[model samples]
Target chain A: MPAELLDGTKTANEILGKIRSQVAVRVAGGGSKPTLATVLVGADPASITYTRMKRKRCESVGMRSLKVELPAETTTEQLLAEIEKLGNDPGVHGILLQHPCPPHIDERAAFEAIPTAKDVDGVTLGSFADMWFGLGGFDSCTPGGIMRLLRAYDLPLSGKRAVVIGRSAILGKPMAGLLLAADATVTICHSRTPDVAAAVREADVVVAAVGRAEFVKGDWIKPGAVVADAGYNAGNVGDVEHAAAAERAAWITPVPGGVGPMTIATLLEQTLVAAERDA
Target chain B: MPAELLDGTKTANEILGKIRSQVAVRVAGGGSKPTLATVLVGADPASITYTRMKRKRCESVGMRSLKVELPAETTTEQLLAEIEKLGNDPGVHGILLQHPCPPHIDERAAFEAIPTAKDVDGVTLGSFADMWFGLGGFDSCTPGGIMRLLRAYDLPLSGKRAVVIGRSAILGKPMAGLLLAADATVTICHSRTPDVAAAVREADVVVAAVGRAEFVKGDWIKPGAVVADAGYNAGNVGDVEHAAAAERAAWITPVPGGVGPMTIATLLEQTLVAAERDA
Candidate 1:
């Protein structure tokens, strides 16, 4: 039997649907609109596209979006100052610093400048720490989306063996943390892992977050496993070889719709949450 | 052949010897002796013994140890205020809030109260974030101690499969992060992990940190695996069944001398580092 699709597109829409209604309700009660301030550094085409999609999500949800575009030559200090200013802005409930800022900039320093309260994009170490320790802070968008997708389909995680491919701060690491918090025994594999296929075979739940297209071999996925492909490469492909994985997986998320839409949805949802908490 | 003992006691003594000489050198050069402020909330017998050992280490190393013993009924606000005062103290180089505060207190809030610069014990989320992201910050003492031990023995960690058998914030979680940072394929298994023995069998290295006596069975250890037993239970027992494991293992840390002494040594080491940085 073909695996059931996790359907991140429909799931994300449902979440945004609730967020949209809540935004209207809050505004009707004379509350301010939830706002997300996205700071785009440099001319990274992918970053530009991601930021645009996020802004569109904000508009569709009846929330406000603020775009702070900076040149490729922006200094780390300048980026930090801009983020701190957004943190102080009363209208900005959430702050998003598009990733892979110019190589010269101290990206970590810039991420740290976003105040914990306004860190809806979950790039700050404070957010990571909160998530890792279950201390209650906004989660990184893609991992947060994956968790929501897992829950929507009622997948059991407690006591399950989960394998997370990649260890990037925003994706693999946080995804592992969330799964650990959910009581799933998590194995983190990366470039240094000598036997990625063997590790994948043991996972009841597999998350492919490494950006390489078709990096996870289909034959490695265990039958009846749940697969969430968070990787969206240049060719609209994911990290996993989808066609083969889907045949073995009990549930599989499609490449374009699996992780992408949910990322923006989680960003918007967390933005509203930050605004409500502030209010 | 029985496994060679990792010999943490000897390792810790060597580290302390170096720290002792450095303290004398710094003081001779007109630098103030490094001071560690230990805020002991409630008189847990174990905590008292632990703090006393730490103070002894401080004295042996020509450092200052200030013990702030608070009442069992101390409010979280009071503890926070006291910690803040210590953070502001020029004499205090590092701060360690002894764990397991009385049930009434918000322990996380208290841990957060310690400034990042003085968080030598590494309880704060800031420290966790820094460690996870590979940015510079103090590591949790036990994990730091474990890392030092690994390096002392010249254990090769990169590209190895390691399983950590606990998820406590200070020990298992931080240890996993450190191993991940060192390029190890890491699996974190806890009480909720189904089939922990199976997980243990496949590891090139196993870290037992669940704080249960003999929780990790001997037969589960793979031949030639390096095992670090971090759990110290009552009756001088460790989390791993040592006798059986040693018979098949390549290297293992003993219960009484392993993980215990090195923890304090790492604390002393981080305190000195913090003082030097502050100076």
Candidate 2:
């Protein structure tokens, strides 16, 4: 039997709808508005589009969005200072730094400078620690989205063998941490891994976050594996080749319809979660 | 061939002897002495013993030791405030909050109150981040101890598969982070891991930090695997049943004679490193 698709677009919209209603309630009560502030460095067209999508989502949910744009040549110190300002701002409920900031900037340092409370994107060590430790506040949007999608499908994570490919701070590491917290025995594989396929094959749940297109082969999947491909590569390809993996995995998330829309949706949901705390 | 015993006690003393000379040099230069402040909540005999051992280690190496004892009934805020005081004190180069500080205390928040630079025990988020992100800084003592012992044996960590059992913040989690930072494909299998033996058998290196004695079976070891038993169970039994694992592993660390001494030695070594940085 072919694997069932873990349709993320539908799942994300359901979450957003709940967030939208909550925002309406707060607005009706005349409470302080929930706001998300995003800082974008330079004007990369892709980043611009991504930021616009996030802003539109925020507005749709009735949350306020603040946009900060820095010139391409901005100094690391200047970027950090601005982030610190937003971190200290009373009205900013959550802070998101649009990644791939110009090459010379200290991205990690900038990410760390954001206050843990305002770190709705869950990029900071504070967020990772809290999330991994299961003392929750905010989580990295993509991982949070993946968890939401998994739970929506009634997939039990407890005692499951989960393999997460890639260890990028924004995705893989946190994803493994989340899975581990969910009571799954998690293995994190990356470029240094000796055998990625063999590791994935052992997993009941496989999370593919490596950016390569169809990096995880179909045969590497267990017969009933729950496959989550977070990769949105060029030409709408995912980390797993859909056609082949579809026949193997018990449940699989598609490329364009799967993780991409969910990423933005999760970010919006977390922004509301962050705003709710402030309200 | 049977595995060679990686001698932690001998390696630890060798490093400690080096630190002693460095301390002598600093003292000769008329610098304010390197100091380690230890906070003990209540009197778990084990906690007291560990604190005394650390103080003794500090004194032996020409570093000053300041011990603060709090009553068992102390509030979380009270404990945090004391740590904060030590954090700001110029004389203190290191802060060690002995673990299992009264079950009622918020251990995580208490650890966070210590400034990142003075966290010689590497208990804070900064240390975890450093370990995870591959930036050089202090590490949790036992894990630091394990790393020192491994490097002393000329073991190569990069691109190796490392399986760490246990997931405590101070030990297993940080150990996996350290291994991952070294470019090892790291797996953290805890009580929740269903196939612990399978995970252990596949590792190029195995770290047993789960407290259970002889929990890691000998037959599960991959021949030629470098095994470090970080569990110092009662009656001197390491987490790995030493006699059996020693026969299978290519290189193994013994229980009492292995990781125990290395813990204090790594603490002292990192103290000197912090002292040197401060100097």
Candidate 3:
């Protein structure tokens, strides 16, 4: 059977709708406005676009957005100080550092500096560990969104075998952690894995986040398995071979409309959550 | 061919020897003795034995060990306050909270109370995340010992498929993270895993940490696989069926002398490391 589309676009819209309603309710009740503050360390084109989109989503949900842009040559200490400022701001409930700071920047150091309370983007190790242990903490955006999509479609996760490709801290590692938290027996395959196809064949759910377009072939996917293609490459492709995978997968997320939209949606949702928590 | 034994006792002795020499050299150079402070929240028999063994190991290596026994009725806040005092002491290089604090007390909060600089036991989420990212943080004891044994035996890990059966914070989860960091394709199978045996059958390396005696049957082991039985159930029985598994495995860690000794050894080694870093 051809796979059903996991409509990330529709699901994301539903999430945004809920956030918008909540924001309106809070405002009516005279509660403080929800706000997400984003820090952009360098003017990378992709990052600039991403931050703008995220901010637009915040506005769409009736929350405030703050943009802090720094020059490309900013030092790690300087970047940390900037994030610290957002963390200390009484009105900024959530903080995000646009991904992929310039090569010279100490990105990890900056990510660690964001206080756990305001870490809406969930880049901090404390949040990652909490995600693993099923303690309530913000999830890393991409993985968190992927979990939401899976739940939106009512996919079975408990006791199922899940294979997650790639182990990047933000995406793959947290993806595996989230799946495990959902009671999935998760195998994390990476570049060093000798037999990714074999692993995928056994997986009931496959998450392709290796960032290589079409790196995961369609045939390797188990029949009727759910596939979440999280990689966004140039030319509007994803980590999996979309057409072929769709033929075999029970449900598959399309590259352009799938995980891409949910990242921002999850970010906005978490920002609202932080704001509510602060209030 | 019968599997070769991964001699945990001998390896642990070797590690202790190294730590002992380092401790002696530091003292000879007019440095203060490395001190490890252990907090015992309640008098569980197992906890007492474990702490005693660990502290004795410290003494065997010429390091100072302090044991803090709190009443079983200790509140989370009270325990945290006690831990904070130890954390603040300049004389204490490392602090370990003996595992399984009385159920009424919040264990996670207590574990988090141990400062990162002094968390040689690696129970803190920060340390676990650091282990995942290879960020030079202290490793959780049992998993750290398992990794050392693997390295000592010169077993092939990179590109190998490892199945860790359990997902407890101290053992299974960290084991999978360490294996992944070592470039192994890692699978974490827990009680919720429907086919733990099937997962084990495909593993290049199997770590039995589910805490159930002989839970991982011998037939589940892949031929030529390396097995590290991290479970120490009652009556000297491990999670793996020893005789049956050892017959088919290429390498294995025997129960009593295996991962057991390595845990205390790694703890002492990490304590010395913390001391050195402090120095």
lDDT of 3 by residue, B1-279 (tens): 788999999999999999999999999999989999989987899899888988888998999999899999999999999999999999999999997888898999999999998999999998999999999999999999999999999998999999999999999988889999999999999999988989999999999998899999998899999999998898999999999999989999998999999988999999999999999
DockQ of 1: 0.95
Arrange candidates by lDDT, highest first: which order?
1, 3, 2
> Candidates 1 and 2: which is better by DockQ?
1
* lDDT of each residue in B239-270, candidate 2, tens digit only: 99888888888999977889989999988888
Q: Cα lDDT for residue B14, model 3?
A: 97
What DockQ does each candidate score versus the true complex, computed on alpha carbons?
0.95, 0.75, 0.95
Q: Tell me how far the alpha carbon of residue B1 in candidate 3 is from the true structure, in angstroms, after superposition.
A: 2.2
Relative to the true structure, how large is the alpha-carbon lDDT of every model?
Answer: 0.94, 0.89, 0.93
> How do the residues A136-223 of candidate 3 rate in per-residue lDDT, one tens digit apiece?
9999999999999999999999999999999999999999999999999999999999889999999999999999999999999899
User: CAPRI band of model 2?
Assistant: medium
> What TM-score quantifies how close candidate 1 is to the native fold?
0.99
True contacts kept of 2: 0.75
Q: Give the TM-score of candidate 2.
A: 0.98
Candidate with more favorable, higher TM-score: 2 or 3? 3
Residue B109 miss distance in model 2 (angstroms):
2.0
Error of 1 at A176 (Å): 0.7
